[model samples]
Target: MPTSEFDLIYRYFSSLGAGPAVDLSVGDDCAILRLEPNERLATSVDTMVEGVHFPEDMFPEDIGFRAVSVAASDLAAMGARPIGMTVALTLPEADEFWINTFSQGIAQAVSEYRLPLVGGDTTRGPLTISVQVMGALPADKALLREGAQVGDLVYVSGTLGDAAGALAFLNGEWHPEPDAAEFLLQRFHRPRARVELGRELLGKATSAIDISDGLLADAGHIAAASGVSIDIECGRVPLSSALNSHPDSESKLKWALSGGDDYELCLTLPEEVPTPEGCTRIGRVTKGQGVKVDQDIDFTAGYQHF
Candidate 1:
């Protein structure tokens, strides 16, 4: 806990700008992000803190990466390509070492998504980081979670429940990982934004929302927003191998159906839309409200944030 300022930067923020997309990075007053002049900008912001959004002792580096990824995922949900980002830091103290590690993680994430740091603010607080990412898309082609009709196919990207399972492991509910426990653990901590997938779905998906919450809960958002009914098939849920192998798969499934924070994309598309390789066909859209799984799994009563 008693870390020095320089060491914090060296450990946490130093490895940033290692990737090709990072034209400029931390230590500068502002970073310059490059993009085609004609591209439109799509942007979003997310903030996390020591205790409010994560464990108090969560690594500062993971916190940094996640802060950016969450906001970027919103852009991805809209079918935009990432362009750049601004990071705002409110810390309890000026721990340079922590900031450095955080910067590296942010840069690492940006490397994956191709957005570099463009600008930001630093301040004093209880270890809070807010990131706003800027992305680009055609003038009028962002995907909204409101185009599903009575017969669209409900699709989801990537497997669900890994983050929730990781959280369970963190809370001591279980242990996981034969070959990549740390990787899965990092998923909950530093999840990647599905920008590429979102971009691919631009012309195909009728409706879409990044699944920050469990599939059921997020699909419900689309249902409510679009004034349609969603049928989320429990059997069709794209669960990770680790999740299916766990002893408490049912409860884990429930968690995936209710718990948020996965940050993947859930979409509704015409049966004709050529879904990308990894996307799963989970269920259907019907003539009513609420979400269910083949008429048997009721998700209308899923998690509610009070």
Candidate 2:
């Protein structure tokens, strides 16, 4: 489709609210923002495309949630609490119904994270969503992936592999109860960023990375960034009942290791600090390179984007 002209702006993008920090809203030539004293701004943007990030037939709400969650994950990695957002969408057609549902999901996320939608753009193209998020934290407290010390303990929040299990269900390996199925699919569709935990750990953590990729891949990120080795105890990964009830825990563990899109935070904490509520210590940062799980531990390979 050719570029959409200016008239469609009001048709789709005009109704969004311009909440706090928005000195000038959309429809203006510029935007202005104000930050509280001593607050440091943290920003992240992520783009998702149909077929690459999600299924073509996925409900619009899920699409909206996933898009924003991806960006929120980045903020969480930096231990920032969200402040506001701008969304840019490109679609193949002007589907009012889809847009409405999508906006509802975005609104739900905004409320959930206590952030507001300040401004953005809407235009014509293949289905794509680009969300830019702004967050803030005290300058001394922001988390960094490079802050890990050799003796720090590694931890992750929530369960792993449920999203991968949902993909299996989507491919028809087996059927599950609707609510049970929904839980797994929800992880894939609208992963929850560990923002609350991130904020809680800001000054306490040595290093952190959000688990957008599977455990090994993301753990590897922490290892590489911090210049340390990570030894994860495979037995410690928290599996949702979804993964526990599966016929094979080994396969589930493997999937947990390699699957992407978990969106949970994988962090390094100085061993002296007790693990926070809701965080599981899955490993320790070491002196070598890469990630190591027990040799006997095994599961499906992590997400292979290629």
Candidate maximizing lDDT: 2
Per-residue lDDT of candidate 1, residues 88-155 (tens digit): 77878775566667677787787888776666666666787888887778876789988888899998
Candidate 2 residue spans exceeding 4 A from truth? 1-16, 296-302
- Give the least accurate 10-residue stretch of model 2, judged by summed lDDT: 297-306
Clashes per model (N, Cα, C within 3 A): 14, 6
- Per-residue error for 228 in candidate 1, Å, reads 1.1
**Pairs in clash, predicted candidate 2:** 214-259, 254-299, 254-300, 255-300, 258-302, 259-302
**lDDT of the candidates, in the order given:** 0.76, 0.81
lDDT, candidate 2, equals 0.81
Model 1 local distance difference test score: 0.76
